[model samples]
Target: MNVQMADAEITVHTAASIDRIAPEIHGHFAEHLGRCIYGGIWHADSADGDGFREDTVSLLEDLELPVLRWPGGCFADDYHWEDGVGPQDERPRRRNLFWAQGPEELPEESNSFGSDEFLELCERIGTEPYLAANVGSGSPQEAANWVEYCNYDGDTELADRRRENGREDPYGVKYWGLGNENWGCGGQMSPEQYAREYRRYATYVGTQANLMFDHDLELIACGFEGHEWNRRFLEEINEAPWGAEFPLDHLTLHHYYGRGTNVAEADEDKYDRMLAEALEMERHIERMAGAINAVATTRDIGVIIDEWGTWHPEATADNGLEQEGTVFDALSAAAVLNIFNDNSDVVTMTNIAQTVNVLQCLVETDEDDAWARPTYRVFDLYAPHKGNEAVRTSVDTPTRDVVDGDSNDELPLVNASASVGDDGTYVTVTNLDCRSAQTVDVSLEGTDLNEDDIRGEILFAEQEPDYAVTKHNADEFTADDLAVPADGSSIEVELPPSTVAAISVE
Candidate 1:
């Protein structure tokens, strides 16, 4: 059979494999900042006064979230865990130093949702918990004590404290982040300084006296998106000054797009610029992966993009409640997720920044109800690939461009990746052209999918909130909207401008 696409071409050879998409790669990040905790996940008036909304939990569960990174973005650096434990009413309230730090007694913070609350939320949602420990202003003993509280099941003071707090069972959290953005918001530390600091924290956390459980603790060092930062840090971590291994399992990198990050969207070029910038996400991964591999002592060092998304500046310049996620943001997110899928070999995990009521969030709550955003819909569609194998793909498309605040650049008209599991193969393609529909031809090398088996669904402005970027559509989209054509060797689908399509054959 022959294949030809009108605008672009995509070829999938299923026999060749990249790597299994890490379920942790489908993780979500929830910070203590803004209403994400107080008003977004925690419900004060709900029938169950345990701090979370059943509705919000159900929505996230539907998305099949694999992991939750908690209590941070930058909040991890300044947060003190001891203050947020024990009974809620008896817990001390302090000023939030990271999100909105001010002079005495401002930005009131109630230590209502502490480590236990976060662990409970993780258990209820059935996700692995990844806690970012404080390293900037925290003592090594403090970080180790936090780990002991969560993972130790023996008879120690902290363990007894955990039992007294009502949780007798150890949470057994395995993922621990050493710090966040140590290159910038974390402490403005140089790579060498942070590398030394990481050794100090990781060493004691592993050697903590009461840690009876014998489990492999995955300690991730803070890494930046740039190749230079990653390269320098990896080089520094290779040294064995204490005659011990780096204790590094992964490196954490953060990347955010849009006006404030790398590119700007405005007027007629809004969607186009945003999509082009979003396409740059893959380049960031490639460059950083190359850097990590170059200096890494072994190839086992994984990369975790713990924070990433499209952040709008004008909406956040005043630092108000997070801007409503829009259909435009959905396209950018799909593109970013596709990039992660393509780079599954190096990326062990990737978490979208601020899962609720903050930067490209999934859900927002008001005085009356919770509103599901377009980004949530994208996450739902990508769930099948959580633990699936990433089938290698080949994309051949025309280059196009739009001007942004930085410069005009050419990017692919169609960007994509493919994943295969027990159900079938899922081919996710995003057409970056915001002005016209683009034709994409996909070839599956080893699957026996017939023309009738090919199906797809699309999300775009017309099919979304339309002119209302921030509008909430509580009335769910009910239709399956799946249809595509297939020849003997290829499946073909047309994606509208600035749209994302989930094409599957089951």
Candidate 2:
């Protein structure tokens, strides 16, 4: 039997609601890299009549993912939209400049699953599509033309071409990202240089908002995690001659942790260190928000974490950036999600790295089968919080000191976030401790709760932190009934180490 060795207190401030949590906060990402596009989402051989793998599509559809960003991480920059359209056989084969793709690990793009296939997949899954345009090696005219091909409902060649390609009406893709990792893979441009390029691209892409189609597209500009770089970039973006007329809806950055800790070899100390690093997501959100408020005072640009999640050393380009999905990675996901909820007012949307067969993916697949990972369970447990109003939660939890080279850091053993909807108040809690269970006391302010009014569920209660999920054992990670003892306005639940729990009180 597991013995509880720690206690944590949580007080939900029901009245201090941040904002209606954007459903897009639960968005996902897919790139051309690895099996993510070809083998994971589509058949390994795109020439086959049924290109999409039904197993993968079913899993994604059930999750009800709000949005999916596509095309590339770095692949978007070098990609030419024209090469991906029309007949698959007639489409040009191109080299994937950044990463290898498909199950073969070849550094070439077959242009098999292109714009139409991707948008069709989104339609099948009932999820919004966010297309990132090429800005590195491609020109603004190309970016604008791609947008027209996908969104324009006119008599133009691009629009007619889209019809000829079988999509009679425009896909009406709403989220248009200008670039990806401009300071790195997208382009080796400096902050000022990228900002100028952003303006030039926006001149074509953003201006088409009223002229092109009925879809009022939201333009996303990629930013750097380095706070100073963001500050300088925003400063130059403010230099646009259009001034406040410069079109920008969201500023994005990528955050991937666990690069140092390999789950296969990590011990308890390494887990603590990784959790600490995950908690740093709060700092990134604050820093990005600060940069926006300080520099773009006149614009209401939201913050976006378009690319994020675990990128352990185990996941490299050689192997399609695939890593074993474990309970530890899922725990970190819950922590980062809580941070997103707390900052929902500014955090408009976030996409977890690769949706399938990639780093910290929610779903994993093989030739015969596909299954949900532990991280998928975490998203399932927290699904109720999506689109609900996120309220403030004060957590008083025990901490463990972790040794990080020259400095020491403390990792809280428990983390949580709460949201309120018409159904009731929902609370999610995570036990960050990997060694022992934690007894948690939750109090919903100004609300009376009885055992009959509450429904609770938990995940990974029977598993260890480093337990990697596989196809045969994936069902073991699903949420099970959690026994919560409630009295008056308080509830007490014992959370197993590295486990996640959710409570819905009516």
Candidate 3:
């Protein structure tokens, strides 16, 4: 196979800082769907006999995940917090409502891993918990009580229940989502209908901030990808007596691509198309931000891509939503994370769907052990960008035309984003071309670099675009030292096709 060498230039403007990239921007999501919660995070008959899987927990702990949204994608809308609380034996075995779970692949939830178990898991991993309250089939009082149960320090029935459940002190969960996908699986409500429901739920859940806990809680509302719907939703929300003072702090939407292209049957053309779809995340963010600006100008509402990643055809609900974690998926993740870093001003936090053993999961698990996937390597590579000041970058890169049906899309062969932190400036570049390498020249606008001040790491350079990770070969996907030759202010980086590289300058 002949490899084509493309050329590109990335100019990093270190002085033009966008905003402090919230560490929570690198957050993750884990729902009851598939094995994400059951065999992935918690095992019933493990060698340790503690229910929580140490192998999985260790990997998550190492990642130092900032925030984890729990109990849902669609599951949270119908989920009643009471059913999953109290004694394990007495806890009712309810239907999973949306997804098949556990090793059995059954539609029922054992309630073995409920609120307390989840909060405990969050504590064990030192990650903040972001709980999505029920709205579709639940009541406002139920939502309020769930908050009281988790965060209230006072002596109340809900607080007593928490004490009885073995947690004497409050969990102090900071982020709370009002619902999940309320336009579809949540309730199929119109923008006005969901907005009314959101206001009602926020009235109860939001009041607890003043009436109960000393700390404040952030209320998140579900927004749609359709900008018109989001505009209408915000318009309805502002109609409340409090207007923009409504308790909403964040607006969220889910983005998942690659549903049409299966990795098993993918070629270079398919990879290009999929990569193009992944880059569409930028448009979604801008549109949502526009909607917020249009209707709720006074409110400080940030954008959150709560559920975003590759949802391939292979990862169906029947098979626990498991799919091959491929290099292509990880490359797309690199591109998306770069977008998050660049848009850190509005993109406060984004949770890839999900954390483990499911669609675009960072880690995969078997009975014996859990291993990091290619996507996990991408997250590990981009970890330095968390809490950093995002700087602007201009990339003049080659493009390839990906013709899908009647539409023609231009896919940039090279893409990059840079950030400035206390350690120094970090720049991540992705070679989106699946069949060619790209030689990229990186230049910092005002700073000159020496060889000693630059360090580079590259991932998936030795693997093909379609390469999928497995338990035995998972270790092979770890990053390797890349040769970044620095001359004056410019650094030359040779990135292999379908690879992600990170360059740090002191």
Best-to-worst order by TM-score is 2, 3, 1
Give TM-scores for every candidate, taking all chains together and pairing residue i with residue i.
0.92, 0.98, 0.97
* Candidate 1, residue 140: lDDT: 88
User: In model 3, which range of ten residues has the least summed lDDT?
Assistant: 44-53
State which candidate, 1 or 2, has the greater TM-score: 2
After best superposition, candidate 1 residue 214: deviation in angstroms? 3.0
The residue-by-residue lDDT of candidate 1 on 1-506, one tens digit each, is 34464678787777678999998988999987766777778853122338677778887877778999988878889889998888787878777776742112135567788899889988988999999899988988999999999998888999999999999999999899999999988899999899889888988886653346777788888988766877777778787566355578888778777754322335435666667777777788888777776777564778888988877765452353376566667777888888899889999998897777777788767645676687787887777788889988889998766776678787777888899889788888888776677878777876666877777887763553233334345444322464577766666777767778888878
Instruction: Give the Cα-based TM-score of candidate 1 against the true structure.
Output: 0.92
Instruction: Look at candidate 3 and tell me the lDDT of residue 250.
Output: 95
- lDDT per residue for candidate 3 within 1-506, as digits (tens), equals 12233299999999998999999988999998887888899995133325898999999999999999998889998899999888787888898888888888898888888899899999999999999999989999999999999999888998999999888999998899999999999999999999999998988888888868899989999999888889989888878776335568999999999999898798888999999999999999999988888888788789999999999998898898899999999999999999999998999899999999999999999889899999999999999999899999999999999899999989999989999988999999999989988899899999998989999999999999888999999999999999988778688888888999999999
Clashes per candidate, residues 3 or more apart or on different chains: 0, 0, 0
Residue pairs that clash (backbone atoms under 3 angstroms), model 1? none
Scanning candidate 1 in windows of ten residues, the lowest lDDT window is 100-109
User: What are the candidates' C-alpha RMSDs?
Assistant: 3.2, 1.8, 2.4
Better of 1 and 3 by TM-score: 3
